[model samples]
Target: MTKIGKALGVLAAAVVLPLTLSGTAYADIPFNQPINGNATYYDNSGFGACGTWVNAATEMLVAVPASYWTTPNPNNDPLCRGVSVQVSYNGRTITVPVKDKCPSCGSGHIDLSLPAFSQLADPRLGNIPLTWKFVRS
Candidate 1:
């Protein structure tokens, strides 16, 4: 199964309720971040590169590949860990934190926690186009 499929299975085992986003996106947050990508979520949470344990209930946790920390990246050692990120999709936005790495994900793909995913788009959508950028932690 694909990584997203596996994650979705994990999500199915955890919760199926969809979260509602409040209000519309604020244009002044300056999410002018250059990075944009697609997003997916998993059910059974696992350990992140940072050595922290996260689960489906963990709010605002995300994963980026190793490249996010290497050259051409500017966030520091743990990549975007602990950084508040603005994820926008379908005119809605939510802020989540970097929790792990997506070894199988491509350059612009993000694996988000179920809770965080719900905040951006409907869980039923499975996958969605998203744009994100680093914000003050």
Candidate 2:
């Protein structure tokens, strides 16, 4: 092969490699599958990532990991489109709506509102290992 052709091939690979790798990472989120991770509580008053106001004390809600979020507008996200999650820990389980994004959470982790967290464990526990899955309502 000519030197120019080899150089062009290498350049093309360099240009496409990062995008391909990122796409692979983006596709790693298991949207409908059970996810094992830790759960933490947060004060979810005021505006949320789903572009709606929330009350931590009254509403049972959760902030899912940002890694699973792909929408340009939070309001248009699939999680915001009537998605809920059933979280289980220490024989306790509670279902909560996905109403926000947890920027600090990893792929399987979630941030639950105060009320939601209390149903699973004492708020003083702060954080706990849990398993959760998406639920349809």
Candidate 3:
């Protein structure tokens, strides 16, 4: 091939090769839509996985499942920004901010702060079945 033809082929391959090797990205969790899952309470002291300091007894906060934590840098995650979830259990419902990650939790599960858990059910209950959905904070 001529010099110009060789350069063009290399350029095309450089672009197309990466595109062919790239994997598709898709969301595993459905935001806004209601999700049924089990919720457990945790003490929110020190810095959370989202890199924010919170008080479990005072602030209504929740930790999303690691499977749903899309970003490597939790501080830059949009879910930890101004996003919150409305959790319903028994006859109670409460909205809480997304402030951390629950590495052991399943994709559909959530870890609520003590106060947030109390708002939905008795914190002493440890775990409770609930339905929740994302909401603007």
Candidate 4:
């Protein structure tokens, strides 16, 4: 093949390679896990289920599944209240503290404070797919 043809072939492979690959590139977190889910935000006032009132515009916090709060589980006894969680979308990742419970969020889903959501993506995106995992604070 001519030089130009070979270059075109390489370029084609580069473009198609990522499309064919399955799964996204994310941090290699421990526990062999990255929980994938949908993320949304709620603008509200007053205290959260966790009983903490925070400035949503500045605080970096998230609301986990309400089941963890409404239902009794030994595993979350001390969700630590302010445990650090890593939230990722697209290629950006932000670490935020777990500050409340999301009674509406399903398993694997998390509700981020507006500020936390803005850190990883534009609020204009509305809802987005993301991956998250707990990390040592």
Candidate 5:
């Protein structure tokens, strides 16, 4: 092959190689399990007391109370601030995080922030009846 052709081929490989490597690296990370149960909220106390959820696209988002949101060593791990939750309603399952505290929520029910709730249920439904299981990731 001509020198110019070989040089171009090398340049293309240089750009493509790293992208290929990164894609594999990303794929190695396991996706979180689907939570299917109920949900409830509690005060964040730097003890991994936050919540996490999985969207329809399987993306996980976590939510912690504002108080614990800035505390160091919360849940003893830098990444443990978010709570993992699975919500089950009428045989359908949805998981989501508590991005913020629910000022209006009573005991045994975590109040999901508007955006988070919307992701799991229709906003027009008002409050959804669901069961959630919490876990630390």
Candidate 6:
């Protein structure tokens, strides 16, 4: 091939290579896996809102959205009912209830109540790292 043709081929390959590589990298991520995890409540008063409790040892507070509370009646979904949460702080585990909605929670953040905070430990720690799962029972 001519030098010009080879340069064009190289440029095209550069563009196409990234597209192909990124496609495979995206597939490596398990999108099907549930986006479940521990989140901290951003309640200034330290008293978090109401939600569902899940898991056994981990204290994860799944904050319910405002839309769910606005309705005259809400369904008893486990996610909405507050599932048990497992909080891991300094390698210690504490369980707390999922209560209330977090006004500051950005999208996936879960808020917890003061009572729940106490159950896990102290809220002063700020942004407690927790791991949790959704349960049917």
Q: At residue 39, give the lDDT of candidate 3.
A: 95
Worst 10 residues of 5 by lDDT: 41-50
Q: Count the backbone clashes (under 3 Å) in each candidate.
A: 4, 0, 0, 0, 14, 22
lDDT of 5: 0.46
Better of 3 and 6 by lDDT: 3
For each candidate in turn, the TM-score is 0.64, 0.75, 0.75, 0.66, 0.38, 0.38
Q: Rate the local accuracy (lDDT) of all candidates.
A: 0.67, 0.83, 0.80, 0.69, 0.46, 0.47
Return the TM-score for candidate 2, rounded to 2 decimals. Answer: 0.75
* Model 4, global lDDT: 0.69
lDDT score, residue 105, model 6? 58
Error of 3 at 73 (Å): 0.9
Among the numbered candidates, top lDDT falls to 2
Per-residue lDDT for 5 in model 2? Answer: 100
> In candidate 2, what residue range of length 10 has the lowest lDDT sum?
22-31
Comparing 3 with 6 on TM-score, the higher-scoring candidate is 3
Superposed by TM-score, candidate 4 places the C-alpha of residue 113 at a distance from the truth, in angstroms, of 0.9
lDDT by residue (32-120, candidate 4, tens digit) is 25789878876665675555676655677887776544225323334533356788898998887766777778988888888888888
Selected candidate, larger lDDT, 4 vs 5? 4
